[model samples]
Target: ATNPFTITKLDVNEKPRYSKEAFKTSTLQRDAYNYLGYSSTRTMMLAQYLYEGIDIKGETTGIITYMRTDVTRLSNEFVDAAMMHIQKNYGAQYLGKYQTTKDQNAQDAHEGIRPTNVLHTPEYVKANVDVSSIKDEKLFEDAMKLYARIYGRTLASLMAPAILEHTKVTFTSNHHDFNMKGVRLLFDGFLKVYEESKNKDVLLPKFHQGDTITMDAIVSIEKQTQPKPRYNEASMIKKLDELGIGRPSTYASIIKTLIERGYVTKEKNLQPTDQGILTSDELDKFFKDIINIDYTAEMESNLDKVSEGNYDKLSILKTFYEMFIPMIENAKVNMKKIQPVMLDETCPRCGSQLVIRKSKYGEFIACSGFPKCRYIKKEEAPTDS
Candidate 1:
């Protein structure tokens, strides 16, 4: 069910748009969040260290601009500096017109993520920064890698758009339609630096719109439809951002809490444990309003309003507590403890029944005789269908 499946029919648009702005925006956000698999909080923490003064070559200097920003707007001074750096480094052809589009919900308090000095290339930083003096070579290395990503992305954002030629070929045979697509890069433009945006080129034979093509071979393959994928760290953060459940500053802490508690495990993907499921079920049954997605999103919006001075903080708190306090008391009195589920298998190390136990790392099988026989094993994750 997790494997890829074959497609039978494909229809191509007459005039396909080659612009990648819409796709780039979402991709960049994910890339930034997932930088080095660091949680949003970790990324910001490391970024802050870079932004704050670091002892480098007997001088204290910031390596990057402010990192806690939801807006992508750059100041005129920085924009001009980036343009000059781009022109000097990559020639005038790579330069692009600077334009700022404001997002209504964006908190434009600081400039978007960018290098403090555009000319301070990642290679130069890696070569010059005295790792021995810093006492942390790995930290300095990671900082350089992250700086490169931000530098490339910020510079690419201001560079010329990549030009691509998309060609789609569709064929009709026996009342069935088969299609193939081809994409050729006409110009690299910004893709020269940000190679992650480049898509694999699919070349197809030349054919006119009305032309019919013969098939070389035909085969039927069996495949199953896969269920929706579980959220990883990057996707989870992206989802929270899209749902307006948390602000940029809180994303990392929120995920960290889930992991620190026994709610979710980040083994390969974020998967809820038996304890998490039970807790969610209880909350859904007793305190649906407070634990609901919509309610939480609305609360976030209200908090934003308070920050903007549009809503009173005390009034909002009072209104929330009026209903929340009763629910908390009711849950405290009525909530039941979830019983451990015993497995058919016995502990490998001890001759005792194995039972499912929940921990910070999720569900695992442990010997029933805990203190006497401290043997435990990780439970296998379920396959998606």
Candidate 2:
């Protein structure tokens, strides 16, 4: 706060928030419509297929470079390869230079999204893989097309930094600070391949610093702050990535696990279920130390220590078990009194009151007045028959 010498120059008139005036503002909604229709697992399967390889045009060809990467990196080899392909196929002008990013956190292990072999375009593949001629061929075609888009994005990323010539038109109407900032594309760069990603810029005729622009209309619109949106898969993964709580590979599994454990449910939005709330609350109350944030932090630290041979994993587990056993016993002794469960609903087939029962699989409702009623809600399959 005290270092003025190290301060960076700021654009005072810049709009901090995303503009609603743009044509393509609903990106999150669009992505949800695209990917979330099929379950996360199925989507991953198709993407993997596209990434691996596809048999098209009577020759085996790879659609995409690779999938399952969080890194926004492009190798020099890949860049060179792309440039070579572009020159050979399109033209010399299509070939672009490598892109530079200031983000030091970018993973450099994998190249940016590109076709494994650009010689095998989607059109070439479609010629052999007819839509109606074969089953699952259409699915392959769709995946291949998406792969082409990814490849285009990689190429565009390698192109020159898109320059935006910003112009601010200021009109002081009744001493109100009303200004409209506009931007025009200074250089199109890689947008030739992937123009959909870029937002259309508004072109202003021209303006000087002191020029008094005429007010077209005074439109005062009242705005209210929107409530935070429910976390989507992409945004959730991004947050997890930022917190360093989970790796890129584990992000999908974490979400999946949360669902499987009944910790959360994905309806129109992801929400914690009653079971999740109860479980978390009970655990927090009875096992405060174990459930606390510090405990998790310490556990991570200890795991790192164990990995480095500074601590023994078995010893840590043994110590934890020793402490936990007594707590379990204490909870069992001190916990609420047990009440016998009963089913209120009657058997659909028989007019008899249902009773609560247990089996190896779990618990269910069975007819208590069963001998005469001949009603049984089978909890589990009979082991023998």
Candidate 3:
């Protein structure tokens, strides 16, 4: 096996590809979680400030379009201004065609989340946001950071496609074909403004059709199969988006409700509480069909149809009631009662086990031996430091 590697073929791609469109609520949340480690709820809150009009240069005006939208469309005015801005700053060759891709589920009620004015650079917007008016330095910083992302993405969307030289090389030895691919950046088009969080260019060494490669050690590596990862706020929202389960405006509230109901907790990632798992298991045993993810998605789709006047509201309601009323009746009689989720803490007053409970206000910690031991834990509110 002298010179055990031989190059058999080389193929390269000549086409250029553009970067993704501007931020919608789902994409924005995913990027925020990945880059800033901000939760979905927090990201929405920060985005809302930009949309609701910020105090800029002593004047109150909105700096970005509506935040709670799934649409990626840009207005004709915005597209023209952005193209002109690109032509002036980056040159005529860098200008891109104005087009947007949307899924069928998109409402298309508002344009993508973008800076209301292309000239309103993130730095300019931040400088003018009066600290005296906002009164919080951290809030100002977070809002500006998110605003920068939206601005950059919007600009990048209208920039020329990045030209890349993708080379695929095949090596042959002992009747075995091995493949390797490399890419070189021919032109950094949209990349000038917005850099994607994942993926980078890999430049490969020059290879001809007939070239010999020196042999390296061949190894069969053993790898352990990884388990499916649990979903965080961003990933959970992504899943929901794919399933068309909830609207953009409701995503933050939905996640917030999960936390408030004590079903989910925020740690390194969004983790479901043990109580949450128990409740899910109990519900699945009794109402698996009603609470299924697919069923939820179907219900959402039906609601959309009703809103669009394509489906009859009464007919849908009738079908739902026919399927649901019997389940409710059966659950009332046959569903087993679940035990309280006890905490590791013991009540100071009666030395009884403390447990999590839900009330009008929200979840709270109370004694498991409730009627006998009337103990409730009061949490101190966090103050701005």
Candidate 4:
């Protein structure tokens, strides 16, 4: 029997387990389609616009607070403003105080997502932008929804904790343990508008914790372990963040660099190709002293110190290049020769090796032999373009 299942952030490399019912089904293929095809990036970009700001209402107006944040802490001013708004607009009973406990290690420098101007309602701002501007309208709509979520959470934090009733059901067959859980919501609390995220319990007809359940059927299936999935943008960002290897602004650029250098491929998600693995391995091997983990960490620290005025900037760069020089020399002498990876499959005109060349159009393919071959490829636009 085939197993149907659902998982969240399950590392993208897990065997599907048999289950009678499931929700939020996801797979490597599904994520690849969503991200590799640019849908996920486009969606995030739209969300960022709403979170940041956009040219709407004849002025650049941002809806929610900054999107790129790990902080759960809200500003005191924002909290005060929200409480005032709730008291005036909603009611005293609807207001609840919440305190989101944050870990000391987390980077919570920025406040939680909030409205730039709580007074600006979605309908009020709608008249400011052109009716034909779908981009502005979409951005405005998303901003308004996120604003509501942040505002609602602020209110809910102060309210009494939501109460829940739960029951558990267990079924066993063929010496295998199977378990199921159900929950029932006792109060709506602050889950009025945020109902979609509310975990409504699956109310089971009265059953005790020790209740025995009869098995209707037993099913078994063969399964195979799958290899680790290639890194996708979001997961890669998370990984990079965890490693402390790069900053918020650098992760996207690093991934883009890997793609441009043929170190990685984006198809079926961002998989490090053979060349990528080889190149990374080679660099790490011969240039270990320059590019290894310790070097990177120390260099980052020095850069931080420089920014803080404790160290000179030029001296750091000089020290880096000075250390790198010997590594380059040693690699030139001892490293095995490797051919440069070419991106284009073939020359546009002569079917020769299409070596990449720098040009006004950024980068282009031309015959490797150049002048003697005298062949250049100009990009032509097709109807599909």
Candidate 5:
């Protein structure tokens, strides 16, 4: 249904939009690894240190709530405290409504990540944690930054909706229709505390419905369709959450395992290594059932059921063993020994020829001279013409 129409009206609207649910959802979606392209496991470890009593000054006390959770449910006591803090600091108008809905798969035992005491702001923690002769100053700073993010998110979740004004202008040229949108923040509200939540505003000139304007220039740029992009650490973790492949508690570990096992390499995004591709092909040829995505997701579901006491854990293990043991035995005999691809270059450290070797870590260019020379370099991806 492609039809051209004249501009009927230039519309403008203003409304208040709540950010609590959005912040809660996005907090889970934003993985720590992807934020700085570092190890997610390290982020979790630091969060754990904050959660489990860190020595602040002389007394040891937890700085934040539990970090190993997918749930975004906040306890009433914490919510009330956060609301009161927001009202006291910002004003009465900034206090938001409390949220109650929880995800179906989310465990009810743990609360969403938040500061242990709203009164102890990130600034106070940073000042207290700072030591004169601190050996790991960077770690302490990073922990403080994370603490601030958690504090801001928690407080923002209990603040009022951000008010915005939106305007749309429609135009028609040669039976073709086009439109432009403009948005401006009318009130900061929760965004006053969570500065990261603000979107870039597009200011537009005032216009009437029937007003005509002359065009300065017209251009058409040539472009081609692009293939789907590869997944990054954050996107991959989000996908895992959607597919029920693993719990939030295990996401960091899963990523670490993939990197350690040489199954995936992180550059700007996660890319399968040469060894990884070969291993996958071999597994697909011999054990498609075991390596299947659906099967793995189903097993995760079964494990969850077992945890909930709906399924027998031993029975599930027995079923998996029955199917897997035979495959393992068969693969041991049939699987071919994969040889490394020898490269044209020589090792810089040693005079030996460089060979692309596959290890438990990943594929790398290593010196052929075994025990004597152990120099290695990361493999580079091929370039297009």
Candidate 6:
């Protein structure tokens, strides 16, 4: 029956949930992509400048700490300052309990990305920042926006969790039960600093148990399960973080390397090119056991252990060599070589046929007779990352 029904049971509960600790490298990149539409490379570049120091007035000021870090814990000094700021600017109740990182992948090398000084607000940075010696206007604006995000996130991390009152209503008819849920904001704690669209509350009309409530109608909505979407730069970083595939310092470079090599192209999402697919397929065929997520993640872990003095770097290198050296030799014997494309033009240097050869950079024209004629046609301008 598509009609109104009496509320059989109404339950409401008040709960408090904390926001995330702070912005780690992965989280910062993800948020920047989601909120500011900034690429990982772009975000990291701006963050580097901010960390290196910005010129405000006559003195140089470093607004943010190191950009590449996995840890979410702020320094004790920063936390103490933030707490004071929170208590003074925001109410005393806004002060939050300290949170610690549980991520096993996190290194203690650096604290999470945050403002070096809480008082240097976004507005201050916007008006005072100079990105270059000549002072780029656009760079100034982008830097300001990124700084604001970091500022808000850092303060929010040290604030108390938002309190919420959730109410659920259940109705039963003909053995079929329907449910309605509502949310009410009880306290804006961390939300005072960092705001998100999801933080909105859905206030419901007051209803008691066994009260008559109008359903309006029971309409059937057809929905199909959709396949998972491709990873954007942000989501890709997140997946890499989850798998522990790379370090904080390497995430930007990893994505940049993939894109630079023509392996992956960044459009709306990160799409693998033909070269990437073929490379992966060939590697999988010959080195599936070794060239995999598990191996990479394990190597990262070993590297971390080495950094922490828990494992020997030489032993790790020896173990890796034992496994990788044999694979290279086996591949050389069995794997098919990618033949270079022969170019119509001949090499003027050695009177040999020129061929198109690919490297980390784009394809370049080179002599096929490499041992005899080591001639390469240089491009108009060379570019290296």
Error of 5 at 323 (Å): 1.1
Q: Give per-residue CA lDDT, model 4, range 271-383, as digits (tens).
A: 88676787788888888777766667577667767767989999887888898888899888877644544765776666678777643235666787667687877687777
- In the predicted model 5, the residue pairs found to clash are none
lDDT per residue for candidate 3 within 160-247, as digits (tens), equals 9998888999889888888888887878898888877756667776678889898666666789999988888888899989988799
Q: Which is the leading candidate under TM-score?
A: 6
* lDDT-superior candidate, 3 or 4: 3
lDDT per residue for candidate 2 within 1-385, as digits (tens), equals: 1111211221223222211111010222223234434444444565667666655645455566555544555566766877776677656655555644322333344444456665555566666653443458656655655555565556655554445567655444444445566775655556656555334566665455555444444557999999999876656655555544543345567778877766778886668876677767777767786766566646766776787799999999998899788878877776543232666787787766787654434456777675777676655767875
List TM-score per model, in order: 0.74, 0.64, 0.79, 0.63, 0.77, 0.81
Score candidate 3 by TM-score against the native: 0.79
Decreasing lDDT order of the candidates:
3, 6, 5, 1, 2, 4
Each model's lDDT comes to: 0.71, 0.56, 0.85, 0.54, 0.74, 0.84
Location of the lowest summed lDDT over 10 successive residues in candidate 6: 126-135
Model 1 stretches with alpha carbons more than 4 Å out: 1-29, 32-36, 39-42, 169-179, 197-224, 308-310, 340-385
Judge candidate 5 at residue 180 and give its lDDT: 72
lDDT of 5 by residue, 107-183 (tens): 55678788888888987776776375345778777776667677777787788889878888777767676777987
Clashes of 4: 7
Compared with the true structure, what per-residue lDDT tens digits does model 6 show for residues 10-90? 898989968787788898888888889999989998898788777877678888999998888888998998899899998
Once superposed on the true structure, which residue ranges of model 4 sit more than 4 Å away at CA?
1-44, 51-59, 66-72, 83-113, 119-167, 171-178, 182-206, 209-218, 221-228, 333-365, 370-385
Tell how far residue 32 is off in model 6, in angstroms: 0.9
* Candidate 6 vs. true structure, TM-score: 0.81
Model 3 scores a C-alpha lDDT of 0.85
Poorly placed runs, candidate 2 (over 4 Å): 1-39, 86-113, 128-134, 172-177, 195-218, 260-262, 286-343, 346-385
